[model samples]
Target: MKKYLVLLVVPMLFALGCKEKKTETQPDQIMVTEKPKLPETVLDSLKNHPPEGMVWIPGGEFMQGAVPQDKQAMDHEKPQHPVKVDGFFMDITEVTNAEFAKFVKETGYVTVAERAIDWEEMKKQLPEGTQKPADSILQPGSLRFKKTKSSVPNLYDFSQWWEWSIGTNWKHPQGPDSNLDGKENFPVVHVCYEDALAYCQWANRRLPTEAEWEYAARGKQKNTIYFWGDDRSKLAQEANTWEGEFPVYNTKVDGFEGTAPVKSYPSNGFGLYDMAGNVWEFTQDWYNVDYYKELAAKNTIAMNPQGASQAYNPQNPYLQEKIIKGGSFLCSDSYCSSFRVSARMGTSPDSSAEHVGFRTVADPEMIME
Candidate 1:
């Protein structure tokens, strides 16, 4: 079987509102119940605008996940259902190389891709008696995508173009030979979930919950396909996505072959940029193909659903994966049609790629502080 890894890695390396009602009974009785004072946190949220580089997403109900009519919708995205999320602040764009560098500088943090592999941990997910790869192969590195010479029918054989390159990390996204010298504004790729979480902690923000992410990406629009609208034509002008055949060819019609600079394209209705294509973003949710089914079965709006309590991918049950939202520049109509607002994907928490990155979200309470 051509593992999903190939199709997955080949890409590059690879809000709420409230209303009040009047009571009918006590016109003459003059009954007055103090409207619950907006909590200080809520008041602070309303009084103060979102922090620099963040946008406030008003809370509300929306249909989250692939619509029934979307031909590109996958099994995991099925049974589109309603989800309610509270208002929160989200980064205006993906964390950039410069921003991540600053975090590393301030905290002396090393990304998972830059750290040596743990053989003990690796063996846990493998069958018994499986021998460890050579120490050279276990060195710190990440997956990087290389273009194929010609189009191939099978996009899943990611090994064809993805190399487990040594010295490839967020700072050197392409490989050991590459550097971010002039690409500080580009989204920082090759960051694992733990790396992203560490940055979030230093920044005092957190990953957006899957529901919060979908709700914000919808941008208060009702059941739209792409973040801008249902029109695919807008993608060429509004988002950075593959313009021609993916993997083998890219026309760069969108003015970018890989990741584009932050805010290179227009912002969505919520004033958030690159929510469609650019790079896939990490979400505070575990991967579970049937998670949506479980939520849909509730037959009621899921309020701030935190996602599956644990990671589960039936196809790769031993590997724990987390949900990744948005799509990357490698996303094209021909393959990985994940730029759709409701499209979803997942990968192991420890995995990193040239086409994956993340942004942060802050709760009202955090923002208040």
Candidate 2:
């Protein structure tokens, strides 16, 4: 089972925006009502002229790991440490299907999910003598989350819900039958890390570093788990996350059964929408379980940390992984409570799924260049 599960290419398979020049502040109990003056070092024109559909994020020093109050934090999210991020511009929302379609139309770029799988390149990551899968199962497709008939006794086994359906691509989110019909405004899913990188390059933007992502997701809030404060009751209203039994029964209390439209919920203090959930966004950094601990041990705040040099996950050290942040609509109290600001998970750089997507960032220096 372990060998086959590892061969599935989905080990656990789990798991931005809008604004402009002004110091993004919303008068609310959760959002920061008043923002501090920007330092002189930050580019004066950075906030003045942002890219279209993008907002300014006045990044600063903040803790970048799971807070003490968060009980659902995994071992990888631990060892809270201070991190400093330079101000940058971020998309107001996750890159929408319409937005991605423009890139595809102009560049004729094809997403990884739209391409056939390769066995020779794949077997390199698997154990020696691993049997290759049947050709029928290798059709261009992706993993789709299919709810179970009833609640399962164990939630640890995610394969019970995730199915590797052939013909599952971005255009066909739930296998070949699904379409993007009215979901033009919806965040594009089934996008791999390489797919995201291509989109970013075309847009003159790049994936945000893990530290920068966490800092901005916090919405300038110092200690709260969720960007909308520590209260779990406000989750349904603040982000598009799972609201029911999960993987079995979804009550759709948040007015969504799957991926909701981008900005379907309230924006964080930084004017970034869907920072807590909706879809997991890819970051520039490689996933390292002990990277936070390494940062904490430095005894000084990390200055615009660029994440670890290499990927490291003791459980799945054989495969390279990249950090994916902000959880997704699949997150729920009963299952993955990863909607919290500091909460994070990683996935293979090559894998794509319905629950995962990405957003991009334009650095101040990069803009100046």
TM-score for each model? 0.88, 0.89
Score residue 319 of candidate 2 by CA lDDT: 56
Q: What is the C-alpha local distance difference test score of each model?
A: 0.79, 0.79
Residue 15 in candidate 1, Cα distance off native in Å:
43
Give the number of the best model, judged by lDDT.
Answer: 2
Worst 10 residues of 1 by lDDT: 14-23
Error of 1 at 320 (Å): 0.6
- Give the candidate number with the greatest TM-score: 2
RMSD of each candidate? 10.5, 9.2
